[model samples]
Target: MKYTVLSLFPEIIDAYFASSIMAKAVSRGIVEYRPVNIRDFALDKHKTCDDAPYGGGAGMLMLPEPLGRALESAGARQRFVESAGAGSAGRSSGRVIYLSPGGRPFTQDVAVELSREAELILLCGRYEGIDQRIIDTYVDDEISVGDYVLSSGEVAALALIDATYRLVDRVITAESLEEESFSGGLLEYPQYTRPEIYDTLRVPELLLSGHHENIRRWRLRKRVEKTLALRPDLIRRGEEIGLFDGETRKLIQELGGEG
Candidate 1:
């Protein structure tokens, strides 16, 4: 998948794309990233992209003109302007996303949904936030990384990109994704590495036994127990939506959960 990110500080986004597994993904052509500097679209000598809100606000808001131009440069078409024949070359393809605290919550499910898209254009707002007109004209989705406010939109954008890029095909193995937390409506079971004895702790006996069926059963029970204790909501939601299989439901019930 391709990600076109618009940010006043492209360096932040660029650094992430150049590091670790993300860098490897890019090298293998499994992922593509373009960080567009929003300030580059500013018309003024000072490159001003923010201004005080018209109705009075605590902080300045990002100006619409520069952001609009930035989005257009990233292949996003303004809803009304497209009819006037001013759309960019790939205007109809990329899904434009804005990072905002007021947007829909960004969850594992949402990441899975976005991972299926061929291209994404992420707008990283600054100051108080981007002008509403920019959202109204060009954005397809507004995603919130969390409930609390953030000092920089790039941070939120990076979080989103990290969650999504790893899920793309060939970025990571399907087995890794399948066993991860939230994959089956439950958190992952605790893992152990080599040196079975660490301090006073030892690897689970079942894991050392090399019994695949027994080990799998042990992991499933632990997953259900952990979810019930830490996040019963996941179990409730899974049961309500019939997301769990008979074995999982039996595990939940045996673990003293409603299932």
Candidate 2:
């Protein structure tokens, strides 16, 4: 997948893209990144990308022109190409997403959906936020990583990129996705390694007993237990989605869990 990120702090995105799984993906041509520096498109000598808000806000808002310029130069060419393949003649469904608080909450489902995209453009807002006019004119979507606000959108953009990239074909083992948290609307069962017993906390006996069916049962029960204790809503949602089966329902009942 191709990802174009527009940000004042392009270096942060650069450092992350050059390290870890991102670097490996880049090396193998599974992923691509283009970091566009918003300040580079600034109109002033000081490269001022922010300004006082029209309504007299406490903090400066990111100016729309420089950001719009960066997005246009970095993404428009790709949009044109994608538009041709889509045969739409004018529009590119290739997303130009702005990271901000006033946006739809990003989730694992969204990540999986984004992993299929041939290209994405992420707009990272700094200072207070970007001008609403720019968002209206250029952004395809706005996404919030979480409820809490951050100093800059760069970190959130990188996180969204990494999460989405990992879901791409061959980027990670398919089995890993099946076993991880949120795959079935439940937290993953506990994992342990090395020492069989630590400080009297023994590894679950079924796991070590070599009985595959019993281990599966134990794990399922524990998953329900953990979810009930920490996030009962997940269990509720899981049931609604048919993620639970008769065996799972029986196990939850055995553990005195509502679901």
Candidate 3:
């Protein structure tokens, strides 16, 4: 998938795309990224991109003109015009996303859905945020990484890119994706490494037994136990949505009884 990010600080987005797993993904052509500097589109001598809100606000808001031009440069179109049967001349087809605290919550499910897209256009707002007209005309979705507020939109954008990119085809193995926390409606089971004994603790006996079936059962039980203790909401949601099988439900009942 290709990501076209519009940010005032392209360096922040560039650094992430050049490091670690993302660098490898780019090298293999499994993903691509383009960071467009929003300030570059500013027309004024000072290249100012923010201004005080018309109705009064705590902080300045990002000006719409520069941001709108930046979005157009990244191949975004006014949705109202598009809906009115405007031609697609010079426009790139991609989902336009705005990162904001007021947006829909970002989740594993949302990441999975975005991974299927051929291209994505991400707008990283600054100051108070980009003008609402920009959102109404160009954005397809607004996503929040979490419930909390953040000062920098670039941080939120990077969080989103990291989550979705790893799920892309060939970026990582399918097995690696499986059994992850939230994949099976429960947190992942604890893992152990070599040196079976560590400061008086030993690897689980079932794991050392080399009995695959028994090991799988043990892991499932641990997963249930961990989720119930840490995030029982997941268990309840799973049950409500019928995400668990008979065996899993039985385990939850047994564990709940023990508790």
lDDT of each: 0.91, 0.83, 0.90
Best first by TM-score, ranked: 1, 3, 2
lDDT of 1 by residue, 119-237 (tens): 98998988799889888888899999999999899999999999999999999898899878998899999999999999999998889998999999999888999999999999999
- TM-score winner among the candidates? 1
Sort order, lDDT high to low? 1, 3, 2
Lowest-lDDT window of 10 residues in candidate 1?
Answer: 83-92
- lDDT comparison, 1 vs 2, better candidate: 1
Q: Is candidate 1 or candidate 3 better by TM-score?
A: 1
List, residue by residue over 119-223, the lDDT tens digit for candidate 3.
Answer: 999999887888899998889999999999898999999999999999998999999989999988989999999999999999887788989999989989999
- Please identify model 1 stretches exceeding 4 Å from their true place: 81-91
The lDDT of model 2 is 0.83
Cα lDDT of model 2 by residue, 20-104, tens digit = 8889989999998888999999999999999899978599999988976887787542222243445423434458898998889
lDDT of 3: 0.90
| Clashing pairs for predicted structure model 3, backbone only | none
Poorest lDDT segment (10 consecutive residues) of candidate 3: 82-91
Task: List residue ranges in candidate 2 displaced over 4 A.
Answer: 77-89
